[model samples]
Target: MKILILGAGQVGSSLAKYLGSDDENDITIIDKDEANLSSLQRHLDIKTVCGHASYPNILEEAGIKEMDMVIAVTKSDEGNMLACQMAHTLYQVDKKVARVRTAEYLHRKELFSDSAIPIDFIITPEGLVTDYIKRVVEEPGAEQVFEFENGLVQLVETRAYAGTPIVGHPIKELHEHLPKIHMRIVSLYRNGKAIPAYGDTVIKDGDRVYFVTKKSSVSKVLKEFRRLDKAYRNIIIAGGGHIGLNLAKHLEKNHRVRIIELDKERVIEIAE
Candidate 1:
């Protein structure tokens, strides 16, 4: 597959690295910075084009017509949208993925369609990060939480701490501890290496454990691994940036939330 990526920032560069690693993918990235392009060229087996990504000539120079997929991840939301629009309108690319960070643009769902913006997919980093933090906060013991099967099932990652009920216990004993909860230990990691999660495999302190369970039983099952922390009530967020503001918005209705930002203008904006 031939892929064209716009922007050479962290998101773009990371995407390029991952996609370029695949033997079947021919990845080309575009950015305005010559230094970033040069750096990517040296480190990855992908092509780099330095120019304004939303411009037609630059897209053509990056071989947009031959691209099977176009991913626009520029820092500017307008630029990303325009790049996707141009790819769809000009090249008629099969897939157009764009990172549009502005809540204003994302809220207007009708703007993105075949007769509109024509973006096949939209990636909102702020929204993604906010949802991730929400999951972590909701599950007291989990370091990471992923929902699957329409929220009916969940995959949780947590550290085995000393004094936990499951610490030093064999995996087979989990059922005995939590008789009503249904859960499974998918994988275990110790010292950054995988350890088989067999029935006789014991959980040790500092071990990273991944488990799967029904969403309703997640909290109950987590207690077997570690003591659940008290439910969060009062919360203090240090910044009023997009991620922080979004988090505060989600937590405010249920918890006492306070936001502290250095910039007075941003604080005023957040207050409104």
Candidate 2:
């Protein structure tokens, strides 16, 4: 795999360093700053190209046609979008990821409708971080939450609260309520280990619960347990990385989240 990353800044540099460590992937990092380029050249075996990567010519010079993945993490969204668009349209790169600040381009369908630009994925660091915080705050009991099929299928994570109403209850007993609810306790995550259990598996307090259910029935089942997780209305985040940006985009639609970052460059990138 060959990866072309624009901008030798923190994110791009980190990505390249990790990618270069993998023997299977070849990485090339392009940046407008010679000093930044030289700095990365010291630590990794990745190729470096010095230029303003927003220009299509720079991408071509970097052999974008041979690249398997193109990542645009430039300071400016316009630059990232342009690089990604060119990678998709002209070079036909297999994967194109552009780092955008506002997230409007990704959230808005009309933005990607343009014929000239065809970006496969748009990444928002600030938004991701915000969403993670929301999950932790709103469902402190749950380790993670994943919504599938456009939110139709829900996978919820929770730490079984001590003395939970469902504690010591067997799966067969819980199924008696719905009879046809179609609930599955796929795997148990306990003490950092994952174990597969059968229907006889007992629900234990403090055990991590991974439950899957139809989106509509999620609330009803949660209510049955009297809801042990935290319900966070406001969230305060300290950093605005890809995680923060992705979180805000995901949770802000349904919840309130705030992120704080002190770096001016990152702040500008996260701020619309």
Q: Pick the candidate with the highest lDDT.
A: 1
Q: lDDT of all predictions, in order shown?
A: 0.92, 0.76
Instruction: State residue 263's C-alpha deviation in candidate 1, in Å.
Output: 1.2
User: Per-residue CA lDDT of candidate 2, range 1-272, in tens?
Assistant: 99999998888998898889999999998999999999899988989999999788888788888999999998988998888877877777888888887655656766763474666777777666555456455554556777678767778876665564676876566787766687777767667788665677777766777888886676556644446555666666667776666666566765687889888899897777
How high is each candidate's TM-score? 0.90, 0.74
Model 2 / residue 239 / CA error / Å: 8.3
Summarize candidate 1's per-residue lDDT along 1-272 as a digit string, tens digits: 99999999999999999999999999999999999999999999998899999999999999999999999999899999988888888788999999988888888999999999999999998998998888888888899999899878999998888898889989999999888788999999999999899999999999999999998898888777788898888889999999999899888888899999999999999989
RMSD of each: 2.2, 4.6
Lowest summed-lDDT stretch of 10 residues in model 1? 218-227
Candidate 1 deviant stretches above 4 angstroms: 161-168, 190-193, 204-207
